[model samples]
Target: MGTWIKETDKAIYLMDGAYYLQKIDKTAHTGQVEGETFFRTGQLKTWLNSKEPPGFFLVSVGTGVSEPQPLPPPPAPPLSQGITITKSPSQVKIYQPYQVAGTASTSLVGKTVELYIDNSSSPAAKTTINDNQQWLVQSVFIAVPKPQVRNLKVVAGDASDVATLTLTPYIEDHPGGTKLNLGGSVGSGGSNRASDVRKVQERLIALGYTFANKNYETFVQTIRLFQSIISGRTAVRGVDGRIDVNGRTQRFLEAANAPQWMLMPSRGVGFYNLEVIDQPWDKHDYGIDWMSNVIKAAGIHYELAYRKNREGIAPIAVNDVSLPQGGDTIDHAGHETGNAGDLALPRLDGDFGGITWSDRRYDRPATKAVLEALRAQPWVNKSTLYFNDPVLINQRLCSRAAGHDNHIHFEVMVPPTP
Candidate 1:
């Protein structure tokens, strides 16, 4: 039960499980006396003491009594080592300028910290450790031409760490715009920057365009062709083949570079006549591959039923599925994920018609056959089909909703990988 007592000059003592300080005046033995009383065994007494400038001493009270033992010194503080990276996002835009920050050990202070991308030997960027053992490489730019996952390795002295970041398309803020600049000259008869042309070509390739070379001539031809396609023009006479950093071409390129969901080709045995609406505000008609497969199967089923009896079967008019990148669209919900599609109801008289939810001519038999085909798809189940047809709802072929009286909306169960 002895306690420690602090005295002048960093000294401490323990007595009777308690601590008491001794005044070493020699003139006054008023405090606990500093004389030792040996036990009958004749062993020297010991006590706890701090290893500072002034050491501690033990004072014995009487013979046959043991001195209180001092507690062991506390363990030393752990050494600060190992570099750790922190405070960075796990994802960034392709052309964004980001900062990599971390702390280094004191031993590594003033040493160089290098950042490597994708395990490249040469450092992409570097910075010196400050006196506080902190390092930061600011305004680090990664020129990613496409969407991908990349690794960043930081090393300082013997300490190192790594981080992963996903790079998306570099879409600039158009103040309600969604475009990115090409950043260098791109076109024919111009000083073609290879890097800039490569970016353009990558985007073109993503959007189903062909560019064989990275030279100015090839770039100019590609640009002209692209302009004509987007403009819906047959002649390329007035379409300029040049694109600067920021322009309509850049905006289109940005949109083209976005992630794509594969659209089912407009071809099949008995279902090749389906028309995909190509309107400006509704130009994009893409969805997950599985959804496309579902649509294709349903169309074939509809056509087969007509061929079996030689009865006239109207072609199914397909509406929007999702945008190029699978996001929100005007006048619709739940299509943001690219798993939903809308098909206009067929006409009873075997004629192509528009979207109609409640019209009496809404061909109930053909619509039912289409639903059966969709539900038969491996990826479709009871809850995947949406329609407002009372008969279909009663039969549990589809769930009823308020606005689906004229059309059928089908959403796949799972979103396929991009």
Candidate 2:
């Protein structure tokens, strides 16, 4: 026997194997018994009928049982994409091939990467990314005709990076042509052979000087002209019409044609040649591109102020940059590095020849402008300006030093070579 309940609309009963219900309780009977509910005749019914606590009878009195619905899964995360350059060259030779390497994202793998020169729309070279997301462009060629700075850019997908490369000119023989016995007068059979005079004429022509005759008189005049141009003044030193091909003339010609040598501005920024000429024989007047760029930028900035006012600005005397190879020079503790330079304070007379501490000609306004310009440069170490001027020192623009009363010593910080 089992328990049974009777109502006006339905009949709820318990049987030997299952709990059953009939449509008798028409009043829509619905209630919970032991955490299970008994609904109307056409609805689902569930009841605890066994000894097990969680056991229940689940059924639909007049309708069929329905299946349960499942929940949805969560969403996925975003993907990352970018390009990075891991290695590049800081210098390259004209018409030479070099390697450029870097990495790309997985999305870019198997895709092509492009190399550009000076932001040109047309790529100079291209390479494909490997499975490991790495890329390398080998034997990339630069076709620049002369020695200068060039910008290199690498691009993949929507990302890119840039670098600078210095292209150096390649020369076979001496920069001034073949070595010669530039001793004794050889023009018009004065003492030497005609071939020697021809070589001199050729060298002079190569140096942008016009010389047609191969006579001794014409050669002497040409040599004097070359000396005057090199000296940047009317007074040409050691010019006695003798072509000592291995002496000062040879040295001057070598320096003049040297691919690595760059002349400092003669009018905008003066060079105290006396100090440079007095250095050891192996040392010469020149600095690397790093220091020269900074000096040129600062000089332009200083001159711009006066140019804007329609006033003439005198040249600023520069001293002791570095030797051709950048090593220790006489009288300088740190100009051994190609990054240090000394600049004499400007004077009212516009002549840098006789500037001194006691000469009441110090152009304070121009000096201040130049200091400010130097501080604004990226490579110039602003804290390295050493001067003894009380006004500049008090303004925190320069530090007081004993011998810096006549000039300001400055240095540029060069990035470590890779």
User: Which candidate leads the pack in TM-score?
Assistant: 1
Per-residue CA lDDT of candidate 2, range 89-144, in tens? 66654323445667777888888777777657887666666667776553333233
- Output the lDDT of residue 38, model 2: 40
In candidate 2, stretches whose alpha carbon ends up further than 4 angstroms from where it belongs are: 1-284, 307-312, 416-418
- The residue pairs in collision within model 2 are 9-24, 9-25, 9-26, 10-24, 10-25, 182-245
Q: Give the TM-score of candidate 1.
A: 0.37
Candidate-wise lDDT, in order: 0.55, 0.54
Clashing pairs in 1: 1-17, 2-17, 2-18, 3-17, 3-18, 3-19, 356-406, 357-405, 357-406
The candidate scoring highest on lDDT is 1
Residue-wise C-alpha lDDT for candidate 1, range 1-418, written one tens digit per residue: 3333333322233323343433221122344656422222111122334332224334442343433345545699765666777545555543233556667678788887777776588877666766666665533332444335666777776545443433233544322223334557577654567777776776665554444255656557667755543443323336778776666666655752232346644656444324344454564466544456556655554454332344677655567665553334566755654456677677877754564646776788777767765664544545757888777788888997777777777765532211
TM values, all candidates: 0.37, 0.36
